[model samples]
Target: MRIVDRAGASTAGCILHGAVLLASLDGGRVYLLNGPAGSAIAVYRLARELSAFDFPRGLGR
Candidate 1:
């Protein structure tokens, strides 16, 4: 499925910040839902654009 989050923060700055934030959650911790789907998709979209992203296993498991 083409995961498309068309709501929430969708700006470059927001995306970058989101990536940094998510990356920091690299140990399987309870990530409090801080924002909406767009905020979350920002990182995922950035990852795909860069072609060098992977959600570490055991994350949010």
Candidate 2:
């Protein structure tokens, strides 16, 4: 999936195994939360950087 900020910036990546939460806050910012059961929860700032590789080989499948 792709997440975009209000400034017209975007990032693309896949959620291999997780529950994603997206929220748009004040300013031109966006928040992306990734929760994967027992693993660590990840919080990302949208439009900061794009995914280098969306999915490689058999990954994210």
Candidate 3:
């Protein structure tokens, strides 16, 4: 999939959850979305990206 950025540049998009969610690379961040939040979750660095994906798993189930 291809997505347009704030600068109007077309970039590759990685679809998540069967197209209901999208992850894209922009500048220096990996943007995550739920498709209904009206905004995105962005990870700007390797550590931040790891932490972002890790935080959700920290809650004990």
TM-score of each: 0.29, 0.27, 0.23
**Candidate that beats the other on lDDT, 1 or 2, i.e. the better one:** 1
Which clashing pairs does model 1 show? Answer: none
lDDT of 2 by residue, 18-54 (tens): 1122233223323334434422223333212224232
RMSD of every prediction:
12.3, 8.5, 8.3
What's the distance in Å from true for residue 43, model 2?
14
Which candidate gets the maximum TM-score versus the true structure? 1
Ranking by TM-score: 1, 2, 3
Candidate lDDT (C-alpha), each: 0.38, 0.34, 0.34
User: What tens digits encode model 3's per-residue C-alpha lDDT throughout 1-61?
Assistant: 3344456665444432112212232333334534444223322332233432343453223
Candidate with maximal lDDT: 1
Worst 10 residues of 3 by lDDT: 16-25
